[model samples]
Target chain A: MTGPTRPAEAVITGAGLAVAGYAGIADLLGPVPADRDGDPLAGLSRRLGRHKDRATRLALLAGGRALADAGRPADDTPVDTGPEAFDRPGGRTGVVASSNYGNLDTVCGTVDAIDAHTYTGASPMLLPSTASNVVASWIAITYGMRGANLTLCNGATSGLDAVHWACHLVRAGRVDSVLVAGVEPGNDAVTGLAGAPAFDGAAAIVVESARVAAGRGAPVRARVGRYARRADLRDAVAAVAPGPVDLWCEPEDGAAEPPVPARHRLEVGAQLGRRSGALGVLQVAAAVAWFGRHPRSRALATCGRGGEASADAAAALVLAAPEDRS
Target chain B: MPGGIAGRGALASTGRTAEDMFAALCAGRSGVDTPRAFDLTRYRTRHAFEIDDRPPGGGDVPMRATGWLLDAIGAALADAELAPDLGDVPVLIGTTLRELRSAELAWRQHTDFDTDRLHFGHALRERFGATTTYTVTNACAASLYVLGLGLDLIESGAAETVVVAGVDTISESTFGLLDRCYPAPPEALRPFDRHRQGMLQGEGAAAVVLRGTGDARHGLLRAVAVNCDAYHPSAPDVAGIAAAIREGQSRAGAKPSDVDLVFLHGTGTELNDQAEALAMAEVFGDTPPLATAIKCMTGHTAGASGLHSLIAGTDCIRTGAVPAITTLQRPMDEAAGLRLVRDTVSGADIDLVQVHSFGFGGLNAVALLERGR
Candidate 1:
């Protein structure tokens, strides 16, 4: 009843990010920006355009940078399918991005659409891009990726879970590589006024099976050795049942080990603008930065919020390759 | 699927009793009538599949649209034989608009909007009084998505049991929104028909009890996966639907042949039917299993369709008989090779059924439900 110890093929090869304090991994390790009293989305206020919302902008920018970082094109192109598709390391690339407030722009538009009829206002373009999934499709269409594209919306865990699932996809041989990103723009009038804390950022990583990344000569950043979901950790206690405990340790060799990094303290009062979906990006940014500094360190992203008070979730181990593996 | 509705109840236009509703559906009776739920008299089209009622607790009742939800939740608890005091069990309610009723009230009274009280997420926690609760407002697919979330919680040992609910009642805001965008013909809902105009806005509430695996008689909730097409918000990526079907089947530890039937999210809309048909064909090819939708019978109940279909499909497997599509005289040519269950097939062993629900955010959710072992 045992499958191959695949070693979690979903490893990060490259990452690209754009956010408030620092652009890319620089901001992750650098000093975080101070939260202003009245201003939210302080880092991204100047970048908003009439057409694209904050989420889409982060997606496009980060996606473009990630692809560029991986040496892929930014624009869509007509390509012949078959073995040649696999020959190109990025051909089988899929996109998985998560965001808390998908298209706040569209939500506002729907409100305007209703208001337009009420007050005889202007007719807004009720574009499908406004929906959360549009970012995924936009990536697929733009990149000509005929592989899986998914958007996970588990609030702060969206980015983390998307990366987790993206890793699974690679392990399952659904795709050779995946572009997993989490983006959130500052909330508009509705989300802003309704107490959605302003968060602005996008983080993406190029993930591939270790074998595939090795085959393509891509640099491997980390190998996610193990991932586990824990619940209700606020009490500093986990309701460890025999069965879940077994599943958690199923793939482990001998020791029943706790998977988080050493010498790490959980920080509170962390504020990101309304892009809660970018929480994964935050986690990745922090982990990658930690790796960049400490080199051999592994990190874990843990959180639980939004009504399910007792629901505790911690994506345990984020491990990087040994320094010489590069 | 995983946990059958051990106890369940529903409130629809045809009445709350299973017998009354099933009998009416069998007789090809349509519960759709004049657009009373919403004031659609201003627009050219003024028709809907509406339900007008409310739950037991008293409050400044908004339009009687979401009333069926209360009854449905209560009935589900009763069916599951669950105690009203669920204690620590989680509650996940899927809705397109939990505040539409309040919004209607506010608009009617010319009052300022209160987002906190009217938000679906907050409202669900208040209504259910659960220790843990969250709202999945992913448009039409909200119900199924919530169900999937509940399944995740159970699988991950987050909760011993979870009550998942989906509810959307007819409202002036929805009607107005649909009227402006989607144009439905003033008649019966016809899924897969070439002449299909749009979707009929129906209202209902459905709740299911999901229990963890080790529990006694915890039915097999075979497979459930929610994939955001990240396509257009309104339209599902046709290719993504195929990917979902493939992924769902793989997760269920089954093959294409294992699916005995398909309970489609057929709203009788042109875009949806075509997209679904193409997706099904792409996944299962021409020799797919028998496909049908209950929308023609129950109408597009928004968030309620997935759970409703899950209930109906489970019943079909439990009873060894697939219910016929009432009043489906003609099937689409593109839907060839797939048998349309027009006449009720008696004593067929339907071991597995796939239920699909595509929501407004281009969120595609497919759930594979196998008969309880």
Candidate 2:
């Protein structure tokens, strides 16, 4: 039988997050003036086409900041149709974005348009944006990331799953670096539909392979260890060392909550107000920020449906400070 | 390269099983008909490729998309000889549209919607006893993306077996958007035809069982690759699509000439057809292999379209028969030197098959499958 992987490490070279306390992430991360709508788009609205939806705006805002934080070029936009126009050097940097209730607000709007007027009255632009992948493509174009891009719309676990995939690809050497992000728009429709009052926010991490970080002289913030997946967290939790650990658990509605003796456990639902996809990432950002000081702590983040055997989706990730492994 | 497609099944508008769908494709039969499952009185387009609502285990009840899913999955597991428990296998399903019917019904009935109970993953996990489940929603190319993820999982030694599937439905929202986007279609959807008008959106579901090729249980899943055009939100980038196809071929250890047939994305829209032609030209040059765009018969099944194409390609290698385009009357200038099959051909001596799926927002995926031993 195989033991758990020997702690392959990647560092958080840069990070960006969108939170409710700040009306707009761009508003907080910017010297650039906010546009007429009072959200700092970094002058990207005009370039990305006006009438950018809330999800689109939030995605690009967080993505740009992540790129900028990583010291990579961030402001390029899709200019032409030809392939030559998009050719760039950071071609190996990929993007894996996650959204649980993906742009459903836009779909609701399209349905409302049909209800208000005729089907033809629906905005042609609105239909395309409804799919979650649209935001990932724009992020790739805006940052000139030509590597593999995938959008994960797998309900609550979307964020951590995207990060997990990013780690896998980086560890596998398929890509040098990846822009891993999770986004959820704060809207009444999603909350009403999901029955969880998920707030609006996005969080992104710039996870580069240890080689890439070392080559770039980037500081290592944390290391992500091997993940275990199961229908129930019972088996998964048993595998991890019992201790005070930072936790982000979105248990199924009636399941008894798992215990976290750690004082630093993030009240993810309380902090983000039940944001689905962005919840796990919110915990990650908070944990990474906390571990920066401790430098010897570990954080356990879990995102999935329920504790029941029928839950079908459950993922547990181990993230810690660089020195913890030693 | 570690992923091997062990078993496959499909439920398309054209036919139910993969064999039946391939037969219908060769026979030039279409399942496209008027939409009666839902109220589309508000939309201009009245026709769709709606499944008959009867699904395995559904027991005469209207299953909608869920029915189609269980039906395809039932066949796939049966083909793979997997029992009911599925034994800790991961079920990764790709779907573009979720059934808004329940959410709409909840709104009408004034009951709180428990998304937990209603999600397809919950249903599959309950019925099939699967432990790991994922619902992929990356737009049109979601199935191949799910399959590609399955490949990664097996290659990374995460799972020994995986059930990858894709499903979507003919619903009010789909036709409404298609009607507004491209108002008119000249009868049957004629993909890759010079006189092609637009696409006819269809619905159904399909599934393929995958295991690591080290077991050599089925056809080798040579490569499954995904790349972004990052060019446009709706239209695909020719250069990006071309690059993804070439990259997929290289990873599969196959040359352009080695590929016996190609199941093109062939969405039938003017720009898509043109862009695909340009993309194919960039990849295969003058002597591209036999090309088939069966969307003319099956209609585009949205996210499930990739699995439909993958299953169809698998049949081509098995039977050594190239299914016909069925709706192509004229070839474009870009398809000048390529052999576009319009009628079914038997004994083609096929080996490798390359399937392409390009979705909204430039998410392009390519899968290379070989004949199973």
Candidate 3:
């Protein structure tokens, strides 16, 4: 594993989060009505339609608040296809968004459609949006970042992975700035399957290279110290015999041990969310919640999801971003 | 000198090694066979080069195709001359399915289950004691993407050595879904041909051992970059392709003027051919470097395509030549402005070749591999 180290260029200038245990997480859940349209065309008015899903609303609210806390524009004018957008303080900004269970409302609606006797009525765009990358796609479209954008889905590691990759992009000079958004919305589909173990919420951080943050006179919120992931879930499960019997036995491989000791010290939610995607989002939200409290504190966050046998993990170290008043 | 093939393993219909697959290609033999993994009764395309089952308990290969990947990884470890104690080695796997078929089969036999229980990443890390690992699942580009990640790990001093592999096997869910999407049954996938209809999905696994500057005896990773189109969901923008090409060439310290051969993505889909051909023509002009497609031999191996092409490029370097684009029967109009490698032989020693992977959600990755000095 690489040592806990921060890249030279990347600095977490601003961080904002909304989680169940954290204050403002519930209010920001917004208003997501059960009966909503599946395929609404993108428009000035339709943009508000996304508010129906608490995830998007919380994402915007938290993201808006983060930008506000950093003294940036409350609403970053969309930087669509122009050198002008890249020239702005956050214009050339790139994004790495994560949602373990991205757009759960879309997933539920799609599943409901598929399960419904009337398959023809199902929305075509629903399936596409239900994909893991949709949140990143939505963010890029919303923010107008034409640079490197990725939505990683590896159980709970989604958020930390996003931040980890963001650090790399900044260090490698891929993007001037990055918006790492870890979002999970309140949806019955997710809550129904695995019960809402962790409160649904969203967290976003504006990251930039130290030089870029200083150049723009932005306040540095935190610094990413190190990041790593151990995907040793295959052996985590007990091995089972082949044929039609013993289907539920975990693999018995000795190497299935987790890289980090089990998280018995932490206070976990009531339910073990079934969806790897959801657990990832919750972990990210939790990390964001933790980071919010300890602005300058060096913190380590790990999010993981295990199957009947397999387990996936993503980990990151968050530290206070150094201040430089030029 | 370019490091010789230090470690290689492959699972295909012929049940062969890296050497065997190469020999088969040289002799003009293909492993394409009848599809037996699922009920293809309702479809017109009932053919696939399938691997027979091997028991899982070190007996017969129970999961014949999937086991091939595990065996290939083992073979790579053996080839690298590394002991079974690979605790320090960082492992990265690229696959779209995540053993989806295995999980699906398990689910069908018994309901209410988490299908990811059979994830390949978990399997490899557990058996090999891999330290750091991640699964890259971006459709067909998964393999190459993982390979690129492995290179990054090595280049950044993340690991002394990185094992990168890509694998996918024929699954009923994928097959049935693709069948429903495009009903051109059992038709051989043909790329850059005007008459090309659609794509045929196939399964296989391949792995490579990438080492940093410390191990000259192993191999050198030239340069690999994963880029996104930032545009549409499925189509590759001309600008995105140009950017990826430029990025690969720049990272490899080669200019467009220095590239020797260009290995096309060639998914055999009509739209893919048009987009890739346009991109190639724009960058390399009329005399684009000797270009060929390998997907014809392997079908659309999805996660395995990127690594498979990388392996093919290595084979090209080792053999002092480029492989032919297996099934391009006719020249399509879209490829008219570009140089297409066809029915020809060349002694042109390609110092640097670019492997292209344009996949789901506009993932356009171009990996540059050179004859390591």
Positional deviation of residue B150's Cα in model 3 after best superposition, in angstroms: 2.6
Better of 2 and 3 by lDDT: 2
Give the range where candidate 2 chain A is weakest over 10 consecutive residues by summed lDDT: A24-33
Worst lDDT run of 10 residues, candidate 3 chain A, spans A240-249
Order of the predicted models by lDDT, top scorer first: 2, 1, 3
Best by TM-score: 2
Docking class of 3: incorrect
- What's model 2's interface RMSD, roughly to a tenth of an angstrom? 3.6
- Kindly list the per-residue Cα lDDT of model 3 for residues A274-318, writing each as its tens digit: 324333333333433444543433333444533332344334333
Ranking the candidates on TM-score from highest down gives 2, 3, 1
> Candidate 2, residues B144-187: lDDT per residue as tens digits?
87787788778777778889998887544455677788857346
Q: Rank the candidates by DockQ, best first.
A: 2, 3, 1
Clashes by residue pair, model 2: A186-A200
TM-score of each: 0.72, 0.90, 0.77
User: Pick by DockQ: which candidate is best?
Assistant: 2
